[model samples]
Target: MANSPQAKKRARQNERRFAVNKARRSRIRTFLRKVEEAIASGDQAAAAAAVTEAQPELMRGVTKGVFHKNTAARKMSRFAARVKAMGS
Candidate 1:
């Protein structure tokens, strides 16, 4: 219960922020899923392309505070490695 005006405003702001962050997270997950599907399909080129497309999205998530910096970095690193491995 937000009795104070300031608290009520904060609650409203939090709701809006939650919606935005949820959408952003969903978009990031969609990109990551594309990469996973490409990899699973055994298409190295497609997987590489998906990874290229996803890298910036992941970093954007980090910058937007949706994901932690190291979490994004680790995901990018692992995906890149997997893409590279698919080529060899």
Candidate 2:
């Protein structure tokens, strides 16, 4: 489909970027899952720590263009709220 040389090169670049971004997204989800597991177990401290670790990874996803800035913020905000609510 990419008849032009430039288009072919761009397609190749897109494929590589897609693979890298896919891995990054998976890694971010793994970090978030750790937080969710901690929260589910009712370990507030561990949940808080896990969220702290995940915060940067999620933000990194936004910076890397894998996630929107507002999306990442909303996720972090909701997770933090849940972790806070777990206090009592």
Best by lDDT: 2
Tens digit per residue, CA lDDT, model 2, 15-67: 99999999999999999999999999999999999999999999999999999
Model 1 lDDT vs. the true structure? Answer: 0.96
lDDT of 1 at 70: 99
Query: lDDT (CA) for every model shown?
Result: 0.96, 0.97
Give per-residue CA lDDT, model 1, range 6-72, as digits (tens): 9999999999999999999999999999999999999999999999999999999999999999999
lDDT of 2: 0.97
